[model samples]
Target: MMGVAAAVFALTVGAQAPAEGSDQKRRLIEQKIRLVDTLINSPAARGAAEGQEAGSRALIRQGTQAIDDARKALADSRYDDAARLADDALRAVSSASRRMSPGEGALPESAQRKNLQDLGDQVAMYRNSIEELSRDAQKGSAAKTLLGHVDGLAAESRQLADAGRVGEAGKRMAEAYKLAVEELSRLRAGQEVLLSLKFDTPADEYAYEKKRFASNEIMVDMMVAEGRAIGDKRHLVDGFVEEGRRLGVQADEHAAAGQHAEAVRLMEQASAQLIRALQSMGVPVF
Candidate 1:
């Protein structure tokens, strides 16, 4: 009789456990749905969807689909699936909001000024770093190009500020800062790649060197495009740019003389110097 009672109790507990889990899952799904709905209805989300270009359109579409799927899952009593879909919708809508331009949403005067001031400080810091670099080496074509972009953006930012379009001005300054930071990051990555260079054969070493160089070239072009997209420019001095050019030239010379190992070594030295320059400019490499 005791064994029979024990078996019945175990069965009852097992049934209650699944019921508890199902209830918990359902509650979670409901909470997620509410959160996603709130985000989708926010001013930022509306601005992104209605005021922005193609990118925001795509994100909105994605979020809409996720919301629809979540609703369907909820109706079918698929709690876990509903939760997952609702979470995805939330992320999609949030990302769309972030992609909206500052022009779409006006900031308060005080807020705008504060943002602009902070961004201006960052840009000034980067420009100062570039100036320091200019003292060491002749600014290369790349550096010149970046400087032109920075100057143009800085001018535009000032104009916007004068016109009382503080939000737009702050956005431009922020973009300029981001561009400078990204370039610093790219240079640091290239330096690390060069430092890690090693190969068993001369052919292998040469191939790797070419590959790394090509990669850096592509990264530079991409960085330039990114800056342009945001109406900004990287701030890098001539000296910093010249060091990379010199290293590449010396590596090519070594490679031409069939000194693959020496070529790799020179490339590494060049990258190291670039990294050092970036660090000196107060860019965090790690």
Candidate 2:
């Protein structure tokens, strides 16, 4: 009985040794996994942080410049200029924040959400301000000056878009609202020059261009005729006259299609050819 008990005790010790060894191996494996995970995340976090910092720095610079410009304008008693500059600076700051924020992979959940929300609000405010400015330019008797602001707004919007600040770019135009108000004011005040132009449509403009070319041909032909009559400078005169006639006939077609600008241009070209022909023959200008 004593011998059997000793054997059983020995067997139990052996079993315990293997179990403990297995546990240690498992712990080592788990620790290695954790270390690798940490190693992978460290670089990604750093990259995200660096990107964010760079973006922030850029935004700060833009904001500073804008503010400086505004202050200068204000000092000069240029209220409108100051306001526009301030608005532009604020917009730059908003755009930079979005670009600086770590992409989804890098930022902690909370940071990303906050940044995005702030960006949205900034865009909305910019749109509103721009719309007001646009109207003021159109109706406040300084429409031309307002046009410059409108252009600035457009440029800023484009810059934000190019800078990967997409949300700001999509913001509605504040200038449009301002333009409407200005238009209303103009209607009531009966302003001079009403900011209007009879710009021809694309089709009309294209037709006119064709007519101008034709007019050149006509003038070329007239030059050739004179050159033939004058003798010796026939080759040069012929070339001009032929080109002029062709252009003039083309101009006529354009004119018939109601392309007055084209017809006029072509007529002028024809005249040029006639002059060239006369000059080549040493003929006197009539």
Candidate 3:
């Protein structure tokens, strides 16, 4: 009688365990769904999505799909599937957040000044490229107008910085960048742009590329900060950033050893990794 009772108890426990586990998983899925829904409907998230060309719906497609699928799975009593779908939804929301930053506060004074300089350089480069193009191009008038606006923005940025308004200066530079980039895109439409800028030496080319890479790195950093790509992306972003930093350090060592060629190669490699990192973060930098 004792042996039979023990056997019955064990059988009953085994039968109950699966149901309990499934219940736990179902609760988890419901919790995750609630959290993800709250985040997806938050003001910041909506604003961030609207900032993109495709609007809010475009940014949340993956996440919404996951939510829908998770609901179906839950209804069907597929607790594991529901949990997995909820995770996917959470990641999608995180990725969207990291894309545009929604409208975060500006960086500190020093960072703003530095960002202004970098952004100014980017805008100037685009302006110069537009100006250097032949006047007979189809977009001649558009390019000229853009250059005028860019020059004005550059001057305004300088004035603002001189008055210790670095934050405003950064905004001006960002605007100038948008204008210049749009003009460049228009000018480059339906034609390949000629590489007109010539470097005096390999070192000069290397320096240019290094500056470009630094600018890209800064922009990505700022975006990450504003968007808070924390939950699932922290480790991945750190890994790529670390790889880029390591490569940069090695490049510096080579440069100090008088290997300009090798330094340039390493610098390019670092830039590539940084771009790769941005892509991994769903930044659409490519």
Candidate 4:
């Protein structure tokens, strides 16, 4: 009986060792995920909002989904899976952050005069594009608004350069360039282009849809806040805000049902409505 008990005890200890190791790994992964989350919510992330890149957007969506999956796995007592998923989340967000960063080659500090000149030329090109877009009666307001922002950024960049802050100046120019590119793309490809999602699989599509819905929900709140701050005294913007909320609800339903494409469409519609409302209230969407 004593020998049998010893063998059983050894088996239990061996199993407990692996379990403990897994738990330790899970904890470490959780810590890493938290660190990555900080990067995801950092200023660079905010800067990334100035424009969209398919790869960067995909990474963010993948990271968000991975984090959620990790938590669910943890709840289900799949500690090893949880750790792996959490690590994946960390990598995704880190990659996304890196992708969103402005190219080092474009930094003004690298070649101050050349970069500045290039930026100026690009700004000029965008100005022409904006002018052409503004000719369309339907897009006039949006074109004007975007042009205003671009002009403001261009002026700021020049001022920063004058102050010997070439790097900062280059950043401003970079932002302007991104904004211009997005606008041009929209004008050329229609509004839906702004909402386009390129994913490797249905799972990727679902993840992106889920993440975009959350983002649009936040945008709705921002639109409302800005509208109120500006005193939508006439409540002219209320209709658009309400429509955005309604669409967001529909988007949530679609996402829950795994109708990712529909969810993305609704989320995009909601975002557009909110952006229009904000623009009407003189708030810059960017």
Q: Considering every candidate listed, which one attains the maximal TM-score? A: 3
TM-score of each: 0.39, 0.22, 0.49, 0.32
Which segments of candidate 3 are over 4 A away from where they belong?
1-115, 134-136, 199-202, 221-243, 273-286
How much does each candidate deviate from the true structure in C-alpha RMSD? 21.2, 38.1, 16.8, 17.3
Instruction: Name the regions of candidate 2 deviating beyond 4 angstroms.
Output: 1-232
The sequence of per-residue lDDT tens digits that candidate 3 reaches over residues 205-246 is 677767766666655656477564565465556446544644
Clashing pairs in 1: 139-238
208-235: candidate 1 lDDT, tens digit per residue: 5554443332223233444421211122
Stretches > 4 Å off in candidate 1? 1-43, 46-79, 105-118, 138-152, 182-286
Ranking by TM-score: 3, 1, 4, 2
**What is the per-residue lDDT of model 4 for residues 201-250, given as tens digits with 9 covering 90 to 100?**
65566555444433333333333443443333213354454445456566
Question: Cα deviation of 63 in candidate 4 (Å)?
Answer: 0.8
What's the lDDT for all of these models?
0.56, 0.44, 0.65, 0.58
